[model samples]
Target: MGSSNTSFRQGFILVGFSDFPHWSSFFSVLISVFYSLTLFGNSAIIILSQLDARLQTPMYFFLCYLSFLDLCYTTNIVPQLLINLQGHDRTISYGGCVAQLFLFLALGSTESVLLVVMAFDRYVAVCRPLHYTTIMHPLLCLSLAIASWVGGFNNPLFQTSLMMVMPLCGYQLNHFFCEMPILLKFTCEDTGGTEAKMFVARVVILVFPVTLILGSYTNVAQAMLKTKSMAGCKKALGTCGSHFVVVSNFYGAAIYTYLQPQGSYSESKGKFVSLFYTIITPMLNPLIYTLRNKDVKRAVWKVLGRGTDSG
Candidate 1:
C-alpha cells in the first residue's frame, strides 16, 4: 500500500508522439483545429436545440445530449494532449490520469447507449408514427436521457477501480492519454484474468449497444419499405440516414479500438485510432447532423436573420 501510494504520487510520463519528433508541430496544429471545431459545432447544436421551438422534439433533445457529451469528451483529453504535443514535459499526475480515464470511459459508454436510444426514437417515429408522441413523451425522453448518463457513469467506476489497484512496473505510458489497454501494459502481475474481465465489460458497453442500434434500424428499414408516400420516405431517410452515418463513424472506430486483443495492439495505431473517435469524430458529428437537417438549417437562418435585422 505504501509503495502503491508512492507510485501514484510519482506520476506517469505520457510518451505521446515523441517518436515522431518532426511531426509534433503538425499534430499540434491538427489537434488544435479539431478541438476548436468540436467546441464550435457541438455548442451550436446545443444552443440551436434549446433556442428553436421546432428543434425541441425527442430527436433534437437526444441530439443536445450528444453534443454536450462530445464537448465534454473532447475537452477532457484534447487540452492535455495539445500541451504534451507542444511542450517538453509530457507527464500527467496520477489523479489527473484516473479522472481522465473515468470521464473518457463514462462519456464514451453514455454515447453508445444514447445512440441506441436515438435509434429507438427513429424506429418509433417511422414504424409507429401515430403513437410517436405518446411513446416518446417529454417524461420518457427525459428518463431515457438520464438513464444513458447513469449507465455511462456507472460502468467506469468498476473499470477505473480495477485499473487503479493494479501494481504497475513502470510509469512511461506509450500513448497520448490514460487508456485501459495501454495502461494494462505496465502492470507487474499477470493480468490475463483482469484483461478477460475488462473484455467482458467492453462487450457489454460497446457490443451490446451496437446490437440494439442495429436491431432498431432493421425494424426502421422494414417500416420504411411499407410506406407509400415518397415525401414521407424521403423525410424518414434524411433523418435516419444522418443518424446511421454518425453511428457508423462512431462505432466503427470504437469497435476497432476496444474489441481487439491487447497483444495485437500497436501503440502507434492505437494513438491514431484514439484521435479518430476522440477528436475527429466529435468534430464531424455536428456537421453530419446539421448538413442533412433542414430544421437546423432553418433555425440557423432564423437566428442569422434576427441578428441581421438587429444589426
Candidate 2:
C-alpha cells in the first residue's frame, strides 16, 4: 500500500500518441481548432438562449443547459489533451487524473440524462401541444435540470472511490485522459467483481438514458405522422431530427466505448472514439442546432444585426 501511494504520488505518464510521435503535432493543431470552435459555438448557444425572447421556451432552456454541459465537458478534457500532444512532458499528477475522471464521468452521465429530458420536452411539444406549457412548466423544467446534474455528479463518486483503492501495476496510462476502463487496465488484483459493479453503473448511465430517448422519439414520430399539414410535419421533423443526430453521435460513441468487455477494449480505437465525443461532438452540437433551427438562426442574425448597428 505504501508503494502504491508512492507510485501515485509520483504521477503517471500519459502515453498519448507516443507511438505516432510524428503525428502529434498535427493532432495538436486540429484539436486546438476544435476546442476554440467548441468554446465559441456552445457559448453562443447559451448566450442566445438567454438573450433572445423567442428562445426562452423549454427547448432552448434545456439547450442552454446542454451547451453549458458541453462547454465544461470539453474544457475538462481538451486542454490537458492539447498539452500532452504539444509537449514531450506527457505526465499528469495523481490529483489531476482523479479530477479528470470525476468530471468526465459526471458531465457525460449528466448529458445522457439531459438528452432524455430534452427528448421529453420535444414529445410534449409535438404530441400535447395544447398542454405543453402546462406540462413543461418552468418549475418542472428547473427541477428536471437540477436532478440531471445532481445525478450525474453522484455517479462518479462511488466509481472513483472504488478505483482509487485498487492496487495498480504500472504508471503508464495508455490513453489521453483518465477514463475508467483504461484505468482499470492497470489494476494488479482480481477486478472481476469491481468490473462487474462498474459495468452495471455504466449501463445505468448509458443504456437506460438511451432507452428513454428512443421511447420518447418513438412517441414523437407517431405524433409527427398524424400531423396532416406538410408544414407542421416538416417543422416537427426538423426539430426532432437535429436532436436525434446529436443523440446518435453522442450515445453511439459513448456506448461503443463503455459497453464493450474490458478484454476486448482496443486502446488505439478508443483514443479516436474518445476524440469524437470529447472534442468533435461538442463542436458539432451548436452547428447541428443552429443550421436546422430557424429560430436560433433568426436569433443569431438579430444579435449580429444589433451588434452591427451599434458598431
Candidate 3:
C-alpha cells in the first residue's frame, strides 16, 4: 500500500520542464549575448562607482546600490534561464524551487522599496535643495537602504511560510520560475482562503511602496515647477528623466502581475512582461542612467582612465 501511494505521488503531473524559450539558434545566441552584456555592464557600474571618490554624493550612492540590486535581480532568473535554453530542461528540486521563490521575492520587493527611496532622494535634492544634504545625509541613506532590505526579506518570509504550511499534492508549477501567483494557481488543495491572505500580503508589501513613490514624485513635480529659473527647471527635469523611465517600466510591469484580478493572469503575455522586469530592465538601467547623465560619464572615465579620442 505504501509503495502504491509512493508511485502515485511520483506519477504526479510535471507541467514544467527545464527546456527554455522556444527560439531558433540565432535567437538563442542573441539572448545569450544580451545576458552576458547585462552582467558585465552592471558589474562595471558597481565597480566604477565604488572606486571613484568623486561619486560619493547621495545620487551616485543610490546608483551604486541600484547596480547591486540589478545584479541580484537578474541573477535570480537569467542564469537559470540560460541553462534551460541550452536544452537542459533544468529541473530545480522542490527545495531549490522554494529557495528561488524566497530569494526572488526578497530581491524583487527590496528593489521596489529602493526605487521609492530613490524617489525620495530626488525629492529632497530638488524640492529641498537648501536642506538636501541635511535631509539625505549618509547615515539616513544607510538606514533607508537597510530598511528596504529588511522589508524585502520580511515580506517573502511571511508569504513563503504561509505557502509551505499548505499541503501541495499533485500539481506541478507551469512557469519557468516560481512566481507566487503562478505557484498559487497549481495547488490542489483549497486555495481560496490562501489566495485572499496572499492578496492582503500583496497590498501591504507592494501597494504601500507604490504609494510612497507616487507621493514622492508628486512633491518633486511641484518643487520643479516652483523653481524660479527656467534653466533650473529644465535641468531638474532632465535629471529626473531616467529615474522616471525606470520607475514607469518597473512599476508598470509589477502592477500588471501582482495588482490585477486573479482571472486576469494571461500566461503568455504575463510571461513576456515578466521577462521585461526580471531580465531586460536590469540591463537597461545602467545604460539609461549613464547615457543620459554627463556627470556619471565623467566619473566613469576618471575611474577607468579611458577616453573617446584614444585608448
Candidate 4:
C-alpha cells in the first residue's frame, strides 16, 4: 500500500496475448467457456458440501476448501483476462494490478497449503481410521484452514513491498495478468538478489506444501496396498488416483513456472503456464472430483434435486 503512485497512477496496459491478434476471438471464446465452467463447478461443490449431510466428513470439508480457494483464485484473474482478450481496453489501474497480484498470490498460496492438508486428511482416513475422529476434530480442521489462509496472505507481503519499492522502467506488462515474476522483469535494478529472494519464497510457499502432499500420499499408498479386501483395494486405488491427478495437474504447472530463477523465465512460457493453473485447472477440478467420486455425484443430485422434487 505504501508503494509510490507516480508510475502506477497512469495505469499499466496488460499486453496479454495481443501478439496473436488473429486468435483473439478464439481465445476470448475459449476463456469465456472455461471461466463460466470454473465458476459454476466450484460453486456447486461448495454448496453441495454444505447441503448434503453425507458430505459432512473431513474429506468433503477439505474438498470444499479446495473448491472455495479455486473459486477465489480464478475469480481474481479470469474476468480480467476475458476482458483484456475481448475488448480493446487492456489497461488495469496500478492499484487494480497490485490488488490482483496480491489476491492471486494469497488464494494460490493457500490452495497449495490446503492440498497438503487434504492429503493429510486422506492419510488419516486410510492409515489411521481408528483415531480419525479424534484427530481431525472440527476445531482442528478450522485451525488448519485458517492457518492456510494466513500463510497465503502473508507469503507475498514482504516480497511485494520490496518489489514495489524497486524502480521499474515501464508500466507495460507483456502478459495478460499481473504476476510477481512478470512484474519483476520491469524493475530497473539488477534483480539477482531479488530473484534469489523470490526463489526462496517460492520454495516456501510452493515446494514445502508439495513435499508434504507427496509424503502424505506415500503413506496412503503403503497402507492401501496392505488392505486384503479386493473391493477396498479397488476403492482406495480410485481415491488415490483421483487425488494424484489433481495434485499433478496443479503442482506441475506451478512448479514449472515458479521454481526456476527469474532469469530463466520465458514470457511466452509463463503466459501459457499461467493459463493452465489459473483457467484450465479450476475448470477441470470439479469434473475430476465428481466423475471420479460416487459420493460427490450423489451429493450433487441430492442438492439439485430438492427443488425439482418440491416443484
Candidate 5:
C-alpha cells in the first residue's frame, strides 16, 4: 500500500491479527521448523556449491544461484511470520515495508528468470553436447546472471513505485507478509491499472520461464527418441524428470497465486498457495536435486568424510 496523501502522518498500519486455526500451535511449530529447514537446506546448497571444487560446474553454478535466491526470498517473509506467531504485533515501518516488497520481488523474479536460463543450459548440454562448454562459457553464464538480476530489479520498480504513489490509510494487509496482491488489496483505492501492471509482471517473470523450460524438455525428448538406445533414453528422461519436478513445484504454486483474476481473490486460498511456493518449494529443491543426482551425492559424502576426519 502507498500514500498519495502527502499530509497523512502515518501510512497503512496492520490493525488486526489473523484468526489462527484451532490447531494453530501444531501448525505454527511445523511452520517454524520448516522455515529453519529451508534456511539450513538452502544455506548448505550455497556452501556446498561454493566450497567443493568438484561441484563447480555450469549446472551447480545455476543451482547455487537458485539456492541463494530461495534463501533470500524465504527470509523476506518467514522470519517476520515467526515473530507474529509468537503473539508479537510484527509491525513493519513504512520504509521497511517498501524494502521488503522490493527484495521479495527482486529475488523471486530472479529465481524465475534463472530457471529459464538453467533450462537453456540443460538443453545445450543435452541437445547440443558438442557446443555445451563453449555455449555456456563462464562469461556467458556471468552475463546471464547479471541480466536476471537487472531484470528482477527493474520489474518490481514499476509495481512498488506505483504503490508508493497511492495513499495507504487505514487498510491493513490480510496475509502474513507483504505480497503484491495482498498489498494492493489493502491500498483502499481502485487498483485497476495496478492490477494490469502486476499481471504483466507475472507473465514476464513466470510465463516466459515456463515456456522456455517446456521447450527445452520437448527438444530433449525428441533427441532421446532419435537416439534409439535404452541408456540414452534413460539419461535424457532422468534429466527431464528432475527439471520438470523442480519447475512444477516452483511454477505451479506461483502461477496459481499470481494469475488469478483481480476480483476473484480468495484470501484463504491465496494463503495456501503462497505457503506452498514460499515454504514448500525451498525445502524441496536441494532434497530433490541431491537425492536424485549422483554427482551431488558423491560430493556430499566427500564433505561428510572431511568433517568426520576433522572432528
Candidate 6:
C-alpha cells in the first residue's frame, strides 16, 4: 500500500524538559554551548583535513567523513531543540518531525557504520602497516565512504516512511523530538508487533557495526602485542582510543535508548541520556582527538602556519 495521501496537518507539541521546569534555563544555555562547540570542532576537523595535503591519508580521510557526519547529525536536531528550550511555543510541524526522525536515524546509523569502517582503517594501518597504503587506496577509501553513506540513508528510508503514516491518537509527543519508541506511545493501535520488528531492526543496525568495530580492535590489539616497538604500540593505541571513547558514549546511550524494553525507560533519564548522546558526544569527539592525537595537532599547526610541515 502507498503512504497516506492525507497530510498530518496538525503540529506536535514537544513537551521538552517541561517536567523539570527548574532546569529549563540551565539546559537551554548548556545545550546552546554544546551545539556551538560541536559545530566549531567538527567543522575545523573537516576544513583542516581538506586544506592540508599532509592530512590526505586513509585515517584522516575517515576522520574527515566522521567530522562531516557529526556536523550534519547535530544540525538536524539542535536548532529545534534550542528553540523548544527557550520559546513559549514548543511545537514541531508534522513535516518537520518526520524529517528529523528520518535524517537523525540515517545519520546516526551512518555514524555507527562509519566508526566500524574507521576501525577497519586503523586495523589496516596498525596490523597491516606495510600494506596500508596499497590496501586503502583512493578508490577503496571512496567506495567505503560511499557505502557508509548509502547504507546509512537507505536503511531508514522505508521504515521512517511507514512510521510516519501511522494513525495517531494525538499530536502531543510525550518527550522531546520524534524518536520511534517514544512516538510509539501516540499510536492509536497495539504496537507490540511493530515494536518487536523495530527492536529487531535496531539490533541489526547497531549490533552488526558494533560487532565489526570490536573485531577490528581485537585484531589490532593482538597485532600490537606481537610488535616489538613501543612507538608502534603507542601510535596504534592513540589511533583507536578516540574512536573507542566515541563508540562507548554513543552506543551506550543508543543501546539503552532503543533496546531496553518500552515503558521501562524513565523519561527524565532518557532525556539526560539523549542529551549526552546527541550533544555531548559530538562535542567531545574533536577534543578527544586533539588532545590525544599529535598528528592532528601538528596538522592544525601546519595548516595555520601555511606549510610548516611537522614531518
RMSD to true structure for each model, in Å: 2.6, 2.4, 3.6, 3.3, 3.3, 2.9
**Candidate 2 per-residue C-alpha lDDT over 1-311 given as tens digits, one digit per residue, 9 for 90 to 100:** 44655547677888887778899889988989999999999999999888888889999999999999999999999888888888757899888889899999999999998999999999898889899999999999999999999988888888899898888767888899999889888888799999898889999999999999899989988888888999999888877888999999999999999999999999999988998999999999999988867688778888887433222
Q: Can you tell me which runs of candidate 4 are displaced by over 4 Å?
A: 1-6, 304-311
- The lDDT of each candidate is 0.89, 0.89, 0.76, 0.84, 0.77, 0.82
For model 6, the superposed segments whose C-alpha errors exceed 4 Å read 1-7
Alpha carbon deviation, residue 286, candidate 5 (Å): 0.7
Q: Give the per-residue lDDT digits (tens) of candidate 6, residues 1-311.
A: 12222226676888888877888899889989999999999999888888878778888888889889888888888888888878677888888888899998999989988888888988888888899889999999999999999988877886686687677667676667787777776777676877777777788788888898899888988998998999988888887888888888888889989889887977767777887878889999889877867667777777778536646
Q: By descending TM-score, how would the candidates be arranged?
A: 2, 1, 6, 4, 5, 3
Positional deviation of residue 4's Cα in model 5 after best superposition, in angstroms:
7.9
Candidate 6 global lDDT = 0.82
| Cα deviation of 75, candidate 4, in Å | 1.1
Give per-candidate clash totals. Answer: 0, 0, 3, 0, 6, 0
Q: Please state the error at residue 34 of candidate 4 in Å.
A: 0.7
RMSD over all Cα atoms, model 2: 2.4
Considering summed lDDT, which 10 consecutive residues are worst modelled in model 2?
302-311
Native-to-model Cα distance after best TM-score fit, residue 241 in candidate 3, in Å: 1.6
CA shift of 100, model 5, Å: 1.2
**What's the lDDT for candidate 3?**
0.76
